[model samples]
Target: MKLAILPGLSLDEDELEITYILASGPGGQNVNKVATAAQLRFNAAGSPALSERIRVRVLELAGTRATRDGEIVITGRRFRSQQRNREDVIERLAELLREAAHRPAFRVATRPGRAARQRRLDGKAHRSGVKKNRKVRADD
Candidate 1:
């Protein structure tokens, strides 16, 4: 099965490796015994499905979740059940991939307008005058 992460990016089910571990938090006695936490690992760099640009972007967007070896590790423990946790992890991975699929908006470089600069300078001058007026006069 292939997961459609975005319009341009789709991930194969074979590329993902899933593991389950004991979850911590509110589930009472069942939490300690059941391995409900789901961890999904995907090697973004080695994937044949990703382009070089998307791979780099995915690695960048993955942040702390990504390993040095280019594997993205997503953990889900919000749900008490293993099935829900597994779905959560997969959804999280898809979200991350979706974020990486989009190109960042280019920031337009702009200098302050003449009026803005003037207003800033005027405010500074007004503040300076106010501070100057607060000082004790030598005559007083």
Candidate 2:
């Protein structure tokens, strides 16, 4: 599988690992028998593979996804089958990697377009006219 690399120097699969746990609630007969819930474990600090820049960024992004030990844990149990849960975990991990892959475009200074500025001024003027019309005249 192509490992997912996220914004931080950390790659999803390299830093993150998953374990299948028994799912809780409902499912009656099937609940006890199947271990379908997926638990993903990722450590933001401990990884040797991540670049210093990316690791810190990934940690910030992980937020609540992170643990005190710098581990980011995510769990999913919506699927009844273990395979689907695994796929979900993989998809989520991939998403994180996809996020990491791109450097956000920096904003270059720009001036408003003449047409857009004109439209904005026109809209504000129109709004003022509408409000003016709605006002009650004390003389009336």
Weakest 10 consecutive residues, lDDT, candidate 2?
A: 1-10
lDDT (CA) for every model shown? 0.93, 0.74
Model 2: runs farther than 4 Å from truth? 1-15, 109-140
RMSD of 1: 2.5
| Global Cα lDDT for candidate 1 | 0.93
Clashing residue pairs, backbone N/CA/C < 3 A, model 1: none
Please give the TM-score that candidate 1 achieves against the real structure: 0.79
* Reference-based lDDT, residue 44, model 1: 94
lDDT of 2 by residue, 1-140 (tens): 33645433335454557888999876887989878899988675887776666667666777788777877688889888888887787677556645544568999999999999999999999999999999999999
Per-residue lDDT value at 64 in model 1: 97
Model 1 per-residue lDDT tens digits across residues 1-140: 99988776788999999999999999999999989999999999899988888899999989999999999999999999999999999999988887777888999999999999999999999999999999999999
List TM-scores for all candidates, in order. Answer: 0.79, 0.65
* Candidate 1 Cα outliers beyond 4 Å, as residue runs: 125-140
